[model samples]
Target chain A: MEIKLSAPITKEKLAALKAGDRVLLTGTVYTARDQAHKRICEALTRGEDAPFELEGAIIYYVGPSPAPPGRPIGSAGPTTSYRMDPYAPALLDLGQAAMIGKGPRNEEVKKAIVRNGAVYFAAIGGAAALISKSVKSAEVIAYDDLGAEAVRRLEVEDMPLIVAIDSRGCDLYERD
Target chain B: MRELDVKEITEAIAGLSKETNVSLSEDVKSRICMMRMKETDEGAKSILETIEKNIKIAGEEDIPLCQDTGLACVFLDIGQDVHLVGGSLKDAVNEGVRRGYTEGYLRKSVVTDPIRRGNTGDNTPARIIYDIVPGDKVTITFAPKGFGSENMSRIAMLPPAAGEEGVKDFIVDAVRQAGGNPCPPVVVGVGIGSTFDGAALMAKKALLLPLDEHHEDPYYAAMEDELLERINKLGVGPQGFGGDTTAIGLRINTAPTHIAGMPVAVNINCHVARHKSVTL
Candidate 1:
């Protein structure tokens, strides 16, 4: 069923989701991919504040192409989530409530999702141009040196997503 | 010797880079359209529709079909009778990539070093493969390879006794392991025999062939059809949601191998499979 979700997703909302549910996420979400995830996790290990507020926030794993003329972002779509597996649990511990990416997550990531009351959503992997249309605005928030891998705060409207993993640790990637 | 200017090569590559990323080839487009018509799963059907719409928007707006514009992979069939003039061939190719990525607004995905991991700022130092042929023309085939599928590729060294069944098993297993990560309805390229590196290179080279082109050898051609059918039956479906079309095409290239070993490699390409060619 189609459902609308906003950022700072709460435990109640995550609990209501299950694997395979269609979702339209609308709100402020942060973007980071492999390099940025490594940096964020390293910073947290040093007891430093994350570049953006992590509590109840949703992070979209993407490194978009440079925006074309008059566009907020260009060809934004989810990257594979498994690359972020090593660092995801740490972000979950920081109360990051949701993640938007594609592919299967590791067992540790799935367990962390269940324990932390978070959800994992999959955006259509190669449908970048279509997905970019929902992004209303985007601004680099940190790690600008990483170029496309930089952390960006994005405001999105009805971004298409599927709940690939739920708070209860159910996963859509698992064959029935 | 016939001489060709490096500038001409650069310009051709630049144009090809932009064109391939924004537009799907007729062969690839028609295959996807045919698969979409036969797809029965609702989720998989919707994903295919989104892919079609994305292709249209990217073409109309001159934007990349996907955010990961990919590493520029250039394959050159250089004629032995032709001389490259004006500049270093490598520099000219990189220059073309830089211009294409910048002017085309494609993402710069290259890193200066594997460990240090600094962005190149411009996508440069394309993965270039050159082959000397018996002609006066230099044929440049540009395939922008995204890592999502590249990372899923696998290489195996099997004993000669393992034979054809072993090769088929390896290719199917690799695709199953890749699942949704490479993006579903992927195009698979299989390289058999040769040394490890040569097999891997052939696997990548196989991707440059048109989707409709079958293997020249009838035996391998039938093997390709069998492999494609088995992959589709995996039910990984479109975007791994489960459906009928898991892979659109599978191509196999083979060469003589060492008496002691048979090396095989599998290279996966996402459905976008963006590539273009120019003969200079």
Candidate 2:
């Protein structure tokens, strides 16, 4: 079913999703890609607080375009989720319940999801224009020097996504 | 020799970049439709349906069909007799990538340094592969490649004694191992008999083939069909949900190899498989 933008999505709601179960995510979802991920991981490694609290929050694995003046974001969409696998465990441990991106995660990530009861979801791999329609607001939160890879806060509505892996460690890609 | 202007080159590149991602090739559309007809899973059938719908939406709206708009990859066949009048051809191509990716509102996913942080802003420094050829015409094929399937790509060098079967077996292993991470039903491109790098190079290029077609060589053609059948039989199907068509198609381009070795590479692209060709 379609979830609207800026709507509060709970862990229970996310757990109910299955592979290809189209969702429209709204509200505040944070964006982080490669560089930002490295910094997050490093913080975790050093036992320092992450850039954001990350508790029960959804982290979108993305590096979006520079928004045009009047728009909140420029064509925001998920990147491949697998790349963020290296740092996912720590971020999840910090109470992050939902992660959004594309593709499958590795064994460690699957295990992390199961252990922490977190969720993995997929935004359409190339559906930028469709995705852009969901973002009602967006602003870079940190690491402006990181360019597109910087962390940003996006407020969206009805952004479509699917559950790729659930908290039970059931990987939709590997399992039914 | 005729001189080509930078603006013309840049515009051509930009136009082609935007076209490839939004316009799913007719061949790819028909092939997936055929595959969906044969698929049995209720979920997979619907997923394929959404995929088709996505193609339509992306085309009609002129937006990238997938979120990973991919790195700007250009394969150039430049005529030796032509002279680039105003600017470096590479610069013109990159400028095209920057304009296309930015103005088209596509994501710029390529990082300046793999180990370092951040993207290059515009998807600049395109991964360009150029081959100088005879005549005055230039053909450019732009395929914006995503890291998901691209990461699963593999190349290996086997003993010449291993022969075609060895290459076939290796490719099957790779695709099977890739599972759904590359996002199936993938387009498997096999480059054989070239050097390790060359084999990998053309393998990526092979994704440019029609979704249902095979290499023209009778032997390579047969190998392509055989591999396609074997991959489908794996039941990986669309999006790895399980069904008849694991891989939508296979294209193998072969060249003479070293006397003692056979270098083979398998480059698999997900069905989103965005690409287009332009002649200027």
Candidate 3:
């Protein structure tokens, strides 16, 4: 059965999810890819504030196409998650609740998710045009120079995802 | 010699760049439809359905099928009998890429430098490969390549003694290791018998071939069929959900190699294999 999740997911809510659970996520999620993740990590190392609130927030690893004249965003979908492995633990410690991306995560990230009460979700890769239907609005919130790689605040409605790794570190990518 | 204006070349490239991004070629679409019919895993089947729907949406709405939009990879078959007028060919290609990325609203994914990475703002300096052939016409093939699958591609150099078995094992192993990362159901492009770089180039070039097309050599064509069977048996399935259709197609290209060494390369392209061609 599919679960309905809203962003700023609570610890209790996240704890209930398990690997292979389908989810329809609604509410706000922040977009960040390689460059933005690097900057966020750098800021954390320097004891500076991150570009957005970390508590209960979910970061989507994506670099979206430019919005057409009338659309809110164009063909926004998950990028490979392994690229962000280096910086994911730090964000998890800062109270980041979940992540939406595709592909396998490293061992370190799996450990971080388990220890920090976080979950990892997979949005279907290459289903960008279909996924974009859920995005209601988007505006760049940081690193505008990064172009598509910039961090953007996206308000998504009923975005489909699958729980690839739960807070307990039950990973869908791993064979039983 | 036939005179072809650089402006015409630029315009053709620009038009192709946009066209390739938003639509899947008929051959690719047919392959996907066939896979969809055979896929059994519920998750994999649903993913394929979404992909099919996305293709339609992208076409009707005139939006890129994927946000990556990819780096412009232009392959040119320039005829020796054709003379270029106006600006240099390279500049015209880059201009075409710049205008296409901007006007088409495709994502600009290229960076100014590899290490000190900064967005070039305009996707410029397309990866252009040229082959001079005997004709009066110039044929350009534009393939927009996303990096997700590109990152999973690999090359290996084996001793000549490793032979056919070694090549098959290597290709299968590469696909196994890539798992869900390259976005299966993928198209596996294999290049055999060239230097390191040449093998890699051939692997990429192989992707430009239609999915239904087989290698010219019967030997290589049979190898492709065998490799595809082994890869699908790995059960990576669509997006690695474990299904029957792990790979939609496999294309192999071969070149004469140095007797001392056997070089092979694997280039994996996601199901959204985007390419278009125009002759000017």
lDDT of 2 by residue, A71-141 (tens): 67665556667778888888888788889887778999888888888888876554565677778887788
Candidate 1 C-alpha lDDT tens digits along B20-136: 888989999998999999988888888888889989988888789999899999999999999999999999999999999999999999999999899999998799999999989
User: Residue A28 in model 1: shift from native, Å?
Assistant: 0.4
Candidate 1 residues lying further than 4 Å off, grouped into runs, are none
Better of 1 and 2 by DockQ: 1
Candidate 3 shows a clash count of 0
Q: What i-RMS does every model get?
A: 0.8, 2.9, 0.9
Provide per-model DockQ scores.
0.83, 0.41, 0.83
Estimate the TM-score for candidate 1. 0.98
lDDT of 3 by residue, B57-93 (tens): 8898888889989989999999999999998999999
Regions more than 4 Å wrong, model 2: A1-26, A44-48, A65-77
Q: For candidate 2, lDDT tens digit of each residue in B1-280?
A: 9776767779998988778877888888898899889888876776677677777766775666776778888988888987878878889999999898888777777777877635688878899999999988788889988777888899889998887688889999998888766767788888887788989987988888886666788878888888899999887766665678678888988888779889999998888787888778
Note the clash tally of each candidate: 0, 15, 0
Docking class of 2: acceptable
